[model samples]
Target: MVADNLKRLKDEIAETASRFNRNPDEINLLAVTKLADVDMIRRAYDSGHRDFGENYVQKIIPKMKILPADINWHFIGHIQKNKINKIIGKFALIHSVDSQHIAEAMEFRASNNDIVQDILIEVDSSGEIQKNGIPIDESNELVHFITENCPHLNLLGLMTVAPFTDDRKVIASCFEKVRNLRDGLEIDGLKLPHLSMGMTNDWKIAIE
Candidate 1:
């Protein structure tokens, strides 16, 4: 069942990216494995799905231990300060970096661990107060802070979560906001190549 769903999802992602004239390889379909047991996750893995997103630190720690070492585990949850030390060198990429303080903490942890942590600055582009992200207005400052001061943190791109709405225009606006923010933030020596947005409800619109 999971494999079938995974194939359909990948096909849809490919189709959508192709429609936008985007190389489907440029769009990674991160299998959100939250609430999934190791066996369930392994089923997706066995089906050739490797990149996975998890919302909690505790849940992913053990799974990482048992899973294939090459699996790209993404930290897609709101990060807590207390666990900054816990995930220093663990994740392949972090998509929920919501503030300057959090980025600083991650930098400290990464420097101490002797590893550079790659992350995306999460922006509240949709203006959803209940969601976790840096407000779009102040995201540029956070991006600059990481680039100028945090030697251990690699600011690869930006991330945002669009509200779960049937209105395709609204979802597309949120994704566009984040992409524009990323473009505006880039300078001569820096380039943010990734934009992590969209989910099951609005994935098609996101790629388009």
Candidate 2:
């Protein structure tokens, strides 16, 4: 069942990518394994899936210890400053960097380890009170701060979480806003290459 589900998701992702004239390979299929156990993750790995995202540092650490070293782990959760040491050298990508304080702590940790850390700036495009992301207006300053002060941190791109709504238009608009924000940053000489938007609920609309 896991293998079937993985194949179906990949197939759907490919079909969605085609609709936008995008190469499906360019769209990374990041399996959210936050709720899955070691056995489930191993099953996904055995099925040829490599990139997996986990929401908590504590949960991901144990999985990383047992999982094949080739699997790329992405930290896609809200980062707490106290846990920076736990996540810095472990995950291949950190996707929820929402503030300068977190970024600086990550930089310090990465520098100490002599590794360059790749991360995405999380933006609150939906303007939700519950979300953890830098406001869209303050994102530029955060980008500048990372680029200027954090030598060990590589700002890969922007990430946003759209409000879970039945309205497809709202979802599309949120994704578009993040994409446009990325483009605007590029225009200003910040080379952001990835836009980590969308999730299980509205990924198809994200591809569109």
Candidate 3:
């Protein structure tokens, strides 16, 4: 089942990327293994999907212990400062990095552990009050601070969750804004190369 899903997902991703003249490899497929069991995740691994996203530490740790070390883990949910210690040497990317406090905790943990973790700055592009990310206006300042304070944390990219809407234009505009932000920051030597905005629901539109 997992292998079939992976193959289908890969085909869908390839088609979407092609529509935008993008290399299929340019778009990454992170298997969101939040509620999936170890067997399911390992099945995904067997099918050549190396990247996995987990939301909770409790669910992820046991799976991590069972899975191979080569698997790339991405934390895609709200991360607490108190939870930082447990995840210090575990994850490869923390996607919900919103505040300075969490940033500091990650910095201290990564620095002390001698682990250089890659991170994506989560931006609240849609102004969702319930979301956990820095506002678009303060993104630059937060990025600057991360660069200065966390030498062990590499700011690999930025991520945003677009609100669910029937309008395709709104979705396109959101992704365009993220792309523009990345480009604008690059002019100032901030080379943020990754933009993780799309999900299973509208990933087709996102690739375009």
Candidate 4:
């Protein structure tokens, strides 16, 4: 059943990408395995899914231990300062880095481990008070700080979470805002190559 679901999701992604004249190959399907158990994740891996996103540190650690070494783990949750040590070297990409302090902590830990940690700057594009991301206005400064001082940290791109809503216009606007922010930063000379936005609810809009 999981394999079938995976195939259907990929098919949908391909169909959606085609609608936008996009190469399906360019769209990476990160299996969000935050809720799935280790056995379930292994089954997904067996089905050829390589990238997985987990929401918590404690949960992802054991799975990383038991799973195949080649699986690409993405840390997609709010990162607490105290737990930075546990996740620094383990994840392939940390997708929720929002503050300078967190970036510094990641740099320190990755430097100690002799690894360059790749991360995305999460932006609170929706302006929600509760979201875990840097405000859009302050993102550039954070990016510059990471590039200039944090040698062990690689600022790959920006990420944003849109509000879960049925309003298509609202969702599209949120994705566009983040994409534009990324583009604007590039104009200023930062070479950010990834834009990790969207989710199960509105990924098609993100692709467009």
Best by lDDT: 2
Which 10-residue window in model 3 sums to the lowest lDDT? 124-133
Query: What are the candidates' C-alpha RMSDs?
Result: 1.2, 0.9, 1.2, 1.0
| Per-residue alpha-carbon lDDT of candidate 4 for residues 122-154, written as tens digits (9 for 90 to 100) | 999889898889998898899899989999998
lDDT of 4 at 140: 82
Rank candidates, lDDT, best first.
2, 4, 1, 3
> Over the stretch 57-154, how does candidate 2's per-residue lDDT look in tens digits?
88888889888999999999999999999999798999999999999899999999999999999999989999889999899999999999999999
Candidate 2 Cα errors over 4 Å, as ranges: none
Candidate 1: residue 34 lDDT (0-100): 85
Q: Total backbone clashes of model 2?
A: 0
Residue 201 deviation, candidate 2, in Å? 1.1
Highest-scoring model, TM-score:
2
TM-score of candidate 1 against the unseen true structure? 0.96
Cα deviation of 38 in candidate 1 (Å)? Answer: 0.8
Span of ten consecutive residues with least summed lDDT in model 4: 58-67
Better of 3 and 4 by lDDT: 4
State model 2's lDDT: 0.92
Q: Over the stretch 70-161, how does candidate 1's per-residue lDDT look in tens digits?
A: 89999999999998887778999999898888988898889888898899888998787798999989987888898999999998998889
Each candidate structure's TM-score, on Cα atoms with residue i matched to residue i, is 0.96, 0.98, 0.96, 0.97
Q: Which stretches of candidate 1 lie over 4 Å from their true place?
A: 187-189
Q: On a 0 to 1 TM-score scale, where does candidate 3 land against the true structure?
A: 0.96
* Candidate 4: residue pairs that collide: none
Angstrom error at residue 98, model 3: 1.0
